[model samples]
Target: MCGRVALASRDAVKACAGVDRELTSPTPLERDGEWARAGGRNASPGCAIAAVRIAAVEADDDGASARLARATVGDRRACAIEDVVWGVRFDSRRGGNFERSFNARVEGLLGGDESTFAAKLAKTVNGRCVVYVDGFYEWREEGPKGAKTRVKQPYMVRRADGKPLALASVLTPEKARSDAVDDFPRREAAVITMPSAGGELAWLHDRQPLFLWNDRDFDEWLFGDWARMARERRAKDVKGLLQWHPVTTKINHAAYDGEDASAPVKRAVEKDAGSVAALFAAATKKRKVDDETAVQID
Candidate 1:
């Protein structure tokens, strides 16, 4: 589930967006120092970070086109990159009391089930967006079953060609009561994830972030009919566009930041191959016995 991400700098975001003018809003800069310390490290949920999106702009004769913009949430306008909160919060009336809404499943979005959390956002034209990230982290577990313990072997997933990945995302404004005063909406965003059924990195996890690798994909993702687009293509089918490798475990600590945090590292094996094989064999034998006991009870 893409719980942690590394953001490109403001300049890198602009480069990806292909715009020269400053796309980030100035309001976030006026905040306290803590707020300013939001981006460019281990960006977890609730942290302020940079994202790229296309906002509808009015043209001559009331026509509009989707123009790329750096997006953040707290600003009055949705045109510039601002320091918005990461998770999308639904209205209390909607019965969405989720502790975290940072990753929206692609299946939930395109399942055509109106009851799903992402259904409404997926059908909306302006709800679509592309989040720019240098890379993201995922954990791989080791050891055997039952007695096995999961160790987070952090891995950095990035584009194979070294370009930044434009991750698919959805956005929404903070829910407020209809009669409430001073209830300005704070915009929030969430990354979308797809299943990793048959990919090389599937061993790391069963899910990966949905991303747009090139300009054509980016345009269709941000400006096309998202519901139809999602139905026609699955993100897992495009898994070849990304590459994943083991990285330092320092990323496990949210506060840890340095070049080494994302640098590729060799996996250090604590147990020899023989010991690992033995552990697996023992675990398999115990599992077979347990299954036989369960069948007899049934």
Candidate 2:
């Protein structure tokens, strides 16, 4: 299960998510610690996480046409991002506690017979969104089931090409809770997952996040129909871009946010560190230049 995620900065996330600007973030990133400097190095469920989704702004025919015609960005150019809550309510049995789900299965979205909330949500543009993160944490259980000697080794999975991963997700149709998140009450969303394949990915978990790779992928995910798309597992194509390595188990505690917390404790993937290091350097430089640019896009 993917319990924790890490992100760079607001600007860096926007650049990677390819959005205009953050629409609403009621709670400021803390003034100090890793949450301030590096965003959340260890973000978990039931917290504020950045998500790019269709904004509440309704465009008329002209703006809608222009949005459809927008190249690369497509409809997402008009989309807005917010600090959305990270968990979705999957069940509400009488007298039972609500079940919060951090991950939703892609199979449910593809299922013709599924009447689950997540499956139904997959059919609407409003329900579609993406959570782009620096990386996420997964623990590999190494031993027999129920064995006392079993060890859980954690690994950080990020793009080998040094780009943030745009995880396919489905947002609940409406805000399911009355409680506020970051002072702005919001709907919940869960990252969609598919069967893991390609190299050692299955070693970590049988299910991996279904990530969108490029402009076309993002465009289709945000606007296209689910039933009309090919059913041969589209998410598998993005697996080659992923790489992972063991990190400090301190990440087990979601509040332990920092660069060092997510850093690889070992040199497992040859491309992992080199690409991530370069990406951080480039993100810093690009953001600096972007800050000074005279053209105001947003």
Can you give the TM-score per candidate against the true fold? 0.70, 0.73
lDDT of 1 by residue, 89-111 (tens): 54464565446588888888877
TM-score of 2: 0.73
Q: Which stretches of candidate 2 lie over 4 Å from their true place?
A: 29-39, 56-75, 90-96, 143-148, 174-176, 198-200, 227-230, 234-236, 267-298
Give the lDDT of residue 249 in candidate 2: 67
lDDT of 1 at 65: 41
After superposition, the stretches of candidate 1 with alpha carbons farther than 4 Å from their true spots are: 21-23, 26-39, 57-83, 90-98, 144-150, 174-185, 270-298
User: Per-residue alpha-carbon lDDT of model 2 for 1-298, expressed as tens digits?
Assistant: 5768886556766887667666775345553321232247787676667788766434434455334534324755568777666778655786765677888887777777568767776766667788778888898765457766655667888889888888888886556454443354367788988887654587778888877787766767776544444255554576568888888766666567766987878533334457789999999999988987846655
Per-candidate clash tally: 3, 0
